[model samples]
Target: MTRETSEQPPEIAEVLARWQETWPTALQLWNPYVSLREPQWCLTTAEAREAGLQDSFAMIRLRGLAVVVDLETVRKLRVENYALQVLAHEIGHHLLVPANLYDYAGLMMRVRLALAGIEDRAPLVANLYADLLINDRLQRTMGQDMASLYRHLREKGIGETRIFLWYMRIYELLWSLPRGFLSCDKSEPVLDADASLGASVLRSFARDWLDGAGRFAMLAYPYLIEDALHQQALREFAHLSDITSAGVGAELPAGMAEIPSSVFDGIVDPREEVLQNAPNHQEADSPGRAKPGSLTAIIPGSDASTGPQQRYMQPGIYVDLMRQIHPDVDEDRLIGRYYRDVVTPHLVPFPVEALGELSGDVLPEGTDPWEPGDPIEDLDWFESALLSPIVIPGVTTRRRVYAEDIAEPEKEKPYHLYVGIDCSGSMHNPRRTFSWPVCAGALVSLSALRVGARVMACLSGEPGSFMETRGFIKEENEVLRVLTSYLGTGYAFGIPRLETEHLQNAKEKTHLLIVTDDDIFSMLAAPRSDGQTNYDIAEQALRRAGGGGTLVLHARAEWRPQEAERLRQMGWVIHYVTDENALFDFAKAFANRFYRSQGNPTCKRP
Candidate 1:
């Protein structure tokens, strides 16, 4: 492509050189990273596109590691009189807007929220919303000539498509441009009225672009859905959207330390290799900006060498995909109809708090705070060394000064959790759709693990068989596997299974939870493995684990009061759920009671 292209005109090259110089000076105050590593120059759109830019023109990518400029587009955009502004605008995508990988994913997800039907337009909408935010910052904050970029586009005789017009009108109003300055020539202005709302939305959230993005996407929804306007919007952003799709399908890049592969649901494009190798492929493709020294703190999955297949399987993603599988299915009903289906939105991805928030006391401050007579464990070396020189024989402050060691507080010890869910014929299979019950169970199980709790997950049905994690463990996938599996085998959860496995020969102090319905009455009345009644086995399980146990039943209040009474007598807490929505809340309340002191909180129940 580069070999086939004509050389960049001297005028365009000179202009790019100026922007290259201007970029460092402009962003120096906002982002020092630009100074350490400057944006690279791509002499043509082909070079820029080859250099990992999604669009044919200018772009900043690789988490601000490099900026790629298509001088050809820059050359044409200059006819509109603000080519450098576009350069700065691409730079803004990296340093600001959805600034980091997480924020970028957040932006994508937020757009997904507003786009239930027109998901094909997610990348495009996200890109446009991002442009508005970045341009607003440049025009309104730094006082750049952002409007000229649009004014020139308008001069090109392109009719203002709704999104394009909505976007331009934003700049016009924001900068006090004339009402009809960015005209569509159509009798009904495509985005005339909403521009005011867009302007207000921009001002109210000029600083918080991510939140502003949600509102902006909502504003663009009507235009997005109108068949003609939608096509026009798509045509207007064709290049950027193509790039977004290209990036979406692109290969994973090495040194992609900021965003995790899991966040991308496996697709990732790292520009480390591309930036290193870019100059070799094209004419005058310069080695781009310098990568910063440390980003392990900023970019997640810096060393994500291996893990279970993870995706952005948030509730919204789940709902979207499920619709693809059963296209005619009602998603709202799917979310609320079953127990496990509703839980997916609330379950945490991991079992343990990656932040390592095990609560513990701070060690007392003092060097050698412990003396010969004092407990040796309490000795503080630093404080004691300082005290020894000033030590006087009669002074009690100096005597015990070295007694207490200034110690880093240890985090709270995590507990073991045992989760048992009913998977009988009446219960819905989680594998079929979004499983709310399994999701609810996961909410508790992950919370338990986050706080350093070992969780034993079990799927149980009566008579034929049951599945268990066998013993306490911390693997989320293992626990989720049990929760997600379908076992529409028996009539009810086998009480005998819990008695023999968890209650009788428990390896650790475990918190037991049983999820079932009123049908569990038969299991409670049935004989256990020990020949004792089911109630007796559960009672013993509670006493042996020493930790409290809970029984959550999804049955009518009047049906199981008598049956639940026997378990309640055994000191097991009982919670009834009339609606599946309340199940997530209950799971969270239960987890907080058990795991709060040990780790950070997970997503709240809906």
Candidate 2:
């Protein structure tokens, strides 16, 4: 009996108390790992909302592997007695289809690609597909009456929407139910054929669920194309959308930037698959050919594992796609990680400090026990043998410590990096577009950190605002966060940024690298608060840095002859590139020249 129609409303305490006892059987249904926590049994709808179960009686949160159920809603729906099936289905979401946050994101990513124009429908479609896989497994393999739960839900109304009918029919086919059973007898040849294709996809890709996400979405595409039908289906099946918000407040999944080429190859439409499989089917010019004007050729998903050349989604597209997956993900972190992923492949080896091989260090002063945790190279086999014929780690192993002569020169430490980039109105926002300047900055800044150098990154737009690290720091994220941020303000890199206290109090020699266009010359010429212009600040900061400076300009070499010469005279090396992409080449060459074993040498400036 429904809760309201009964003589008295069911006590929420009594419902929760009863369901609490059933939680064990629900968990045991999956034969899950012993440590899996029991589902959170919220006693009321308000409690359910707080537990992240939005519109459903039960929901799963991938962030904490949390399964929440509203006992109030369960009682209202009269499925309080079906606690095992409902809770087990929620558990199946955690253990099966889109189990963890990463695979959930992967499933959404593939579905979004398939539902290209109507991508917002992806979450609904993904939730439905996941339910199909989970419910099918529960019903057929595990002997759970998942169909009965749908039948109880089907009492409200069985809409005539093609997507809804096709969806329900799939369940009917999977459970060997009659045609009119769950779908309200709304059967048609097209609906039946499509339902058969979907059922086949569900069973075929049960083990490899992510691979079938695109195919399932493609099957639902035609039904969802009409706005009216899509909206109707959404309203009809709103209760089943347990995982629609699964990625909310979740960490951004790693390695999503690189999509495998085979992923797109697997994005086959089931209708097309059926056509090709038919005996009467005739081949086109080529089988599996992408439609004209389609992105098949452009969006090449080369696997990094198999080939050196790996393809990445555009920064803007990736950001949009990820936002759909994770609504509240930090945009700065996304952009920072994006550039990091892109530049990782191009990163050269961290410069090896060429401390000329240790000289005058032959005197063995003492021997110490060498634990197994110590480097194998440190073990002195002769001394260890003398202690015992058989060597035993930490017991018989010995390492010889030698004293070096005091006359040897101290090893040189790497110079700190001060990277300044112009985030002027002219610059594109790296969050929205691929900013080569930001990419190049990430490359160099991360390289410096890899070599154990402290770096202070600054993004400046003069006459407006600027941002930078607290001081010289080794944190890659902090440096990258600064490099990738966009300040669409003034017209140039604020030359006065060089006057920061960090540079003034530098203990080690610091290299200043500024990336900007010819517009920086305009900012440099503008007078500062003091009578001295920014030109004086640049020269003075260069002197204070003590390690010299390089100004990488994305401008024609002949564009600003006099101003460029003035900076060159201030002991600044000037490199000009007509194309912005060459900044990466410049950073690579600059790191190679200064950090290599060849010793401190000037980069060949253009």
Candidate 3:
């Protein structure tokens, strides 16, 4: 659609004039990448639809780019100068404008053919076009004026040579802007009138080129313009090599022999003056002026004064807090906080058993058989109970107990716990409230280790690749260390190979605990054996392990009903806790169910 009436207001007229002058060139530049044509400036949804457009504003191409601007939307959204400029920039793309010398060459060729024979002065036109092209390229590449565009180009793939050429061209083109007016060394007849015409044409061309380029650059590189200053500040503090190496640097890579040595020498090396700037380096590395114990001091803060206070919240605090709330939260119990808040009340009414009762004695429920001579109350007995495996009902088969059960304890076999943790990109939310999987995994590992279960923590990502940590954990510090080292190994697209491999391994009764957001059921159930997913492989392993197979699915707030049901149907006893406090409750319930079957009277909910 045509621009708004010039009679509307002087400010409106000025804006339209500026837009008309700038948009043509910008559109031309963007045309090569995205085809743009006939832009309609709409004022309402009705107007946009009447003009065959679908969005408030969009670059649609029936044949070429058509930038549709909803005028009604502009008023409704209260779009100002910046927004107007952005809209005009999109229109500029429709105009197929050029921003650099190479691109302008094509534009010049088109213009020359269009205006042929009218201007007899071909040499002057050619020279003027060349100069303008160079100047525009230089301004775009090296001048601070188009630094935003340069930054965008840097993010893309523009080389150092192109940037340098852009700068050099700017200087040369500035000299050529007024060349027609200046007296030359080898002068021919000075056609003053023709020269003037040439100057006017060149000025018109330059103004349009610059405006279009600026507008298009802003739109094309929107994020760069907003982030340029911050990025510049970051560059100031960054290693020089990092900022300037190869594609980003002021010079080419080592093997590019065409680059001159003089040009190479200009490349700055912040590391060169290391000896003299040692103090400055140290100062830069020194902790900033943030006070200790403040919020700012905790993260992204100065380390010098804060000491280790903000390094990480003390593990002791976490352990003490867990212990105070759920006194039974020890090493061997799989404690989780998924549905703790919602399900703890439901679980509290049930009789929660302890570890000693599950493994040491076969006492009936509600019967206290502890005597003064009984060794169950001793710390060593509790420690041994913590390490021993308890046979939960429906989980393990009944086994024979030897004299070593109460006397010399049999050495526990380290069980290989293949923990498949979902660390896909979607799980990258670091906020405490959203980090249930990480927290739950940590607590579960701790519980397993405390109860003498040899735990192997594995993060499932990609296909077969998993970060697995084995060996018995003796303390909380070791557990945290392993957990902290677990980095997200990118997104997973298929069922993890571990699931299949775990099913294949027949030697040991492997307990595979999959801590995930329950999105893998479809993939896992693909090759169902008798309409069952490979979950039977896990169940069978647990059965082989005397019924100790455990599958714990830690869910987020938005639970998938079908997936949850499928997991439950697959024989996974789901412990759903909503907060950290409930993790202990879940652990206590789990311990009581499995650990107190032997009636040692030591089983109690913490």
Candidate 4:
């Protein structure tokens, strides 16, 4: 895409000429197997912007494993001669801190937790922490002239905001440079003290960089709390910022919805640590630290201990974290993934099918000319001899083909699943909070899919529009998208959803499972749009399905006696879960009862 342009000056041309040879050396600094494509050489600033290297002379795009450099901006920043330092730093982004897309999202997740109310400053804080880790390793161990490169940038009259000064002060402390060498002599004792702590954190968590992310962000929080100071830092550090858009246009990373329990241990504030360890305060009597069991010391965003099933971040917090990482992420797809991640750990094992012995009689059907590649066992020498007394290879070839009159094996397949969830105004939104009904539906449906069963998931609310899969399908995401969605329109699950075309024409036995509350009995007694009542429709649906049906209610068993008995008389097994969390237990039992195995005498075929 590069073309000739008068915008390219002689100095820019000179930097481009030598930068090609610098890539291999940058790669070697990491390891011998560290490989990357050649960096995009944008001859002018316009070309650099087009390549998405905006506001920085060099940047890396994690989506394509691409490195982009603007020779013009490199010269403008007056660091054209330090190609190895710049290229290796960009390479360091790929090799180390926030290495892949998942770790990048992880880094953002931790940083967001630390910066609670000031979350818009996450990208800036994350980028700074990443740069510190990469540049520290390069300068201290790899023997790259990273300090000289930074000194040049400092000499460029970059405004020394508190954040910038504090940032540079940490570098000065890390490298043992004189106080004014990188950070000008404007440093105060508070800045020096924080810088000391920052340097200590960098060294301690160098190998486990993601663990250090929260601490570093906590250190940078106060510096960036004010909007004006953050804007100044952005303007001053624009040329050095490389990872601000690292996750743009990249696929969303999985497993980020659940934060590991150990992550909270690394979120200690450096300032708080210093106060707790000071000699004047007695260790046991110190008030600097939070009480042992309190969540006050934990990062403010999510508490893993509070979830009903497996520990997970809040849905709204997860959505916010993802949006910060990828601005254009679709909220619908993101919310679906959040609940899918939450319910994954609670799903049952895939159902196993029993194998019966083959019972078939082999009988000769007809003879055909055998090709040279045909199996020799199938050749009929007598038939070939009848065709010709003297055998010519291709001319006298004959083979007897056999057909098998095989009786079908006794092995049973898993029943297809028809899962209906109530999405009424009473039900909590799964996107904003945890919804046990949605979780139960996902757990059972995904387990069904794992066992080679098709699933038709429906979300219904009475007296309002309903959402469902196009039909019974095998796609997990489509099924989840329907379950995780909220209708919030009507009172209870629409019983007429049982009259869908897929259910009416099902060829195989299907387990009909509906999750609702006591209100469903009210809906069941209500009449349908047609002349028949919903009770008649429910009975017909059970008959058409041919498999036993189950209604899982989030209410006490004694709540609806007459209606429950009528449905029970129609061959629907009523499972009552008084607590919402009990729904997962019901799902596990239901799957085991219906889909576990064919030979298990304890479970009857649905």
Task: Give the winner by lDDT.
Answer: 4
Counted clashes in each candidate structure: 40, 1, 48, 0
Question: TM-score of each candidate?
Answer: 0.57, 0.80, 0.29, 0.85
Error at 433, model 2, angstroms: 1.5
Which candidate number would show the highest TM-score if scored against the true structure? Answer: 4
Give model 3's clash tally.
48
lDDT for model 4 comes to 0.82
RMSD values, in order shown: 15.8, 7.0, 29.6, 5.6
Kindly provide the TM-score of model 4 when superposed on the true structure, using C-alpha atoms.
0.85
Lowest lDDT sum, 10 consecutive residues, model 4, at 286-295
Q: Rate the local accuracy (lDDT) of all candidates.
A: 0.59, 0.81, 0.36, 0.82
CA displacement after TM-score superposition, residue 483 of candidate 4 (Å): 1.2
Comparing 2 and 4 by TM-score, which wins? 4
Q: Write the per-residue lDDT of candidate 1 for residues 383-491, one digit (tens) a residue.
A: 5556565644334223233123333443445557778898888777664434446767877887777656789888888777788885787786677777777788888
lDDT tens digits, residues 1-606, model 4? 111224433575677888888889989999999889999999989998988788899988898898889898887766767889899999999989788999998888788877767788998889999999999999988998788888878877985898788889999999988888888888987778778888999999999999998888878877887789888888988988899888878999888888787777777677777766787954443222222323363543434323453467778778888887788889888988887787677665554444444457788888989778888888889999999988776779899988776554445567899999999999999888877788788888987887778999999987887999999999998999999898997999999999899999999989899999889988888865678998999999999998879898888877879889999999999988888888877877777666554442123465
Off by over 4 Å in 4: 1-9, 282-310, 350-409, 528-530, 597-606
Question: Could you tell me the lDDT of residue 65 within candidate 3?
Answer: 33
10 residues in a row with least lDDT, candidate 1: 303-312
lDDT of 3 by residue, 530-576 (tens): 67555555455445434344444444535766665665675665655
Q: Candidate 2, which segments miss by more than 4 Å at Cα?
A: 1-14, 32-34, 158-160, 226-228, 276-298, 301-310, 345-411, 525-534, 591-606
